[model samples]
Target chain A: MSTSHLHPFDAALALASSAAGLYTGHTSPAYWNMVGPFGGITAATLLQAVMQHPDRLGEPLSLTVNYAGALAEGPFTLQATPVRTNRSTQHWTLSILQPDAEGAPVVTTTATAVTAARRETWGVGDMPMPSVPAPAQCKRITPAFRSEWLQRYEMRPVSGALPEQWDGSGDTSLSQLWLRDAPERPLDFCALAAMADIFFPRVWLRRARQVPAGTVSITVYFHAGSDLLATTGSGYLLGQARAQEFRNGFFDQTAQLWNEAGTMLATSHQVVYFKE
Target chain B: MSTSHLHPFDAALALASSAAGLYTGHTSPAYWNMVGPFGGITAATLLQAVMQHPDRLGEPLSLTVNYAGALAEGPFTLQATPVRTNRSTQHWTLSILQPDAEGAPVVTTTATAVTAARRETWGVGDMPMPSVPAPAQCKRITPAFRSEWLQRYEMRPVSGALPEQWDGSGDTSLSQLWLRDAPERPLDFCALAAMADIFFPRVWLRRARQVPAGTVSITVYFHAGSDLLATTGSGYLLGQARAQEFRNGFFDQTAQLWNEAGTMLATSHQVVYFKE
Candidate 1:
């Protein structure tokens, strides 16, 4: 929305309505409002709507949603189609539609999913668990200071989020935390996807530099031993993510999850955008 | 291919076939020859196949292929399908089929493609550039030195690839070089993806520590500029990429790309599977 062509109000109203349609797809707004505006989280919710829960050893894959357009302020509509559901992986396509004006079309984006059964290949790729005792024993940092948007999830930092150390006194630049599916819904990889995307600014200590806001998109590869103990509408969540990339305005992070025992679990990636 | 499985001939045949099928989705001894037991290069090739090329700007999109399974002796078949082609973004789905002789299926993986008409975003993200004037100003570290890879891309070392002092004159923790696309190609985002993946090993002076040999999968992402100008790529693929997380045989690197103006051209993220 710009003055070069369209009025701001016209664009905002149009975006709001389009956001409703874009967020919910062809469905009503009430359904999608429950689906947040965060593209990564929204993508997770879309995956949840189509793919059935993986039963005992059942690997019906649910298609994924890729955020083609950066997440902006407004409503969004999502469209999903089931391609095939087999024992190996459930496949589908999810589309996100961004609205403009009454007659103007919004940005539409989609992704295909392929969930498969667990197999062994010795991906052999595992980062050792932190030397820290536990998330409970770690310090606690208030999220309100940075993310007003993270209120949707119950976040309890394990290492309490490290402070900005000028001389690099930190032993580890990583952080860990436990969370609950807010609104108490069954947790899935979607939740993990959402959780990883928001874990950035938290990991990058706010050392008095201006927060350069930008967009982020993530790709998650769920491997064996990665699953949630949290029930769909109830349970606890554990998020172990480390900020590894913050070069220029582009940042990247990889996160892993596990119930306990330090067992390796689902791996997720987060790409954060920065505006200067 | 397995021993407890079906025909040995079929398994052996698929092994070679899958390797060749990786690049063109057609099996041949030529492609297989290009692929080897090296997982790092193999993974990079597979990612390139799935990545959307710039020449295909107006064509349909596809995921190309992702690492389904690598036996180090993989007969991996990479398959891709056009998801959809639209005015803005094109999507694709790619599958890598890993065959098994005794097992039902060795490995199956799929990835989504988001191909969009890219726009130019101008920025000088405060990143520094190497002092190298251009590729012509840089000298290739001879192949006689047995650095074939380094020769392909012009590496103008800010500090000689060797230690200045007997006790190690410079920071062993870091090294900077000017590297560019050799001989020039369509220099687009996919190539940008390729550039990022390869720049990691150069981050540190090869301190008698085998780098690439230990690296596994280098997952690279580009958040911005796509075009690799004949001059730009000719000047400096300047800047540096550093490892952020390394544990349990897997390490990750985040790369920052800078132009001669000290402007940030793009950013890259990659996960490397390697051992210390």
Candidate 2:
């Protein structure tokens, strides 16, 4: 595949050969978070490594990424190893590490991919999509802050907006928005994986102030196949996220991503570390 | 400490040192599922390995277990490695492997533990406890089925009950129940982890017929510390679980565990593979 015309997400995910099961890449400043690269991109890049591997079987069923340490804004290496492969499922462990640094990897992502020769079975989606205005009707909130990654996505708030100050009025930590890649990239496993983490920290939504908050671990379960993504194409997705509990300098958030047809594409969960 | 009078849960989790950072265990028939050991017990056992580690620090903040293959009912070796240890957090990778197996490891579990010297912080749990009758008022659904694991916990259904047959009547995949360890074991991290997975598959609750189903991956985030667990101690906990989506032979379930005081303890998410 030619790389010159690839989307920024695809281009940033491009890797250079280092060795068997290992590749090297640079951090994209465009997707930079306050500290390291945006977690979604980092997660997407890790999934890309597995997808590009010749031995990988089936499609991504679930992925878990643990941010073990801070990533130095420079070059880094990714090591992806197939931990196990069953008749219908495969397991992989991937790590993004900074060379010459002692200790554990900066980020570790584990995934389960199932290549089930699926038999037509029963299915159900009990969770109802939220009643919200159409994407065009919602107002796009431009970045009033200086987050490079925030600018890369077109986000229209359908309900919750980032609180300006801690008024301590509303206690519900819920956010519903319409989101799509700014330059408009078609939906795929990689893109969907990244979109899962695009929601702002639930703590921020609940409390008016931003504390030292970052996702320590996040997991995504993909429910849609490539055909669904192809049919959906590059379009806005309804993203809804809410926090279940917040306690002892930590909290947990659960989120769902859906197509306009109310088809649930992915559901994600993450435990975040926050300082009061 | 002598384990002669230890709870069955603790006894089943008992491990014998085989080598450095590795232990051996046998499948306890008391906790066996339809196929291998109950996945909840398996998950608890993996967490037990970390807690028993000499150099382990802090308590589990999050755990992700990927069932890579069917665990053979025999002696299995567990290799738990502390991948990284920071000032306030630690990361671990664990594998359950049956020796002499040619292919993949049986189960792979990864965890992040935070040893944070937590300062008093603002906390809020917006997720309300489901309106259910008290434990004493609800009927305990004795398992007429054959799974040994079902007998280990006393479950009182408050909302969704296991369908008598696969009759497609209800479309809501929600289950609310009061549960506690049978014979009354004190609430601890291992026991709590096991309780998080005790809910019946959400698909079965929504569909009329049972299809082949198994959890591919499950992640649990602990919101309570040892102090909270100790205060709650050996009491019934309210659990509510619901599915957000089911498609392409996979479905996702989210669950919460809370004490009688309406304190949210842990939240979990899992994706299951299903067949028609």
CAPRI grade of model 2: medium
Candidate 1: regions farther than 4 A off? A1-36, A52-65, A68-76, A82-91, A119-125, A139-141, A146-149, A160-173, A182-186, A202-210, A224-238, B1-219, B223-276
- Note the residue pairs that clash in candidate 2: A121-B276, B166-B208, B166-B209, B167-B208, B168-B208
Indicate the worst ten consecutive residues by lDDT in candidate 2 chain B: B108-117
Candidate 2, superposed: residue stretches over 4 Å from native: A1-4, A100-119, B1-4, B101-117
* Clashes within 3 Å, all models in order: 33, 5
lDDT of 1 at A99: 59
Error of 1 at B3 (Å): 42
* Interface DockQ per candidate: 0.08, 0.63
Using all chains and alpha carbons, the TM-scores for the candidates as numbered come to 0.51, 0.95
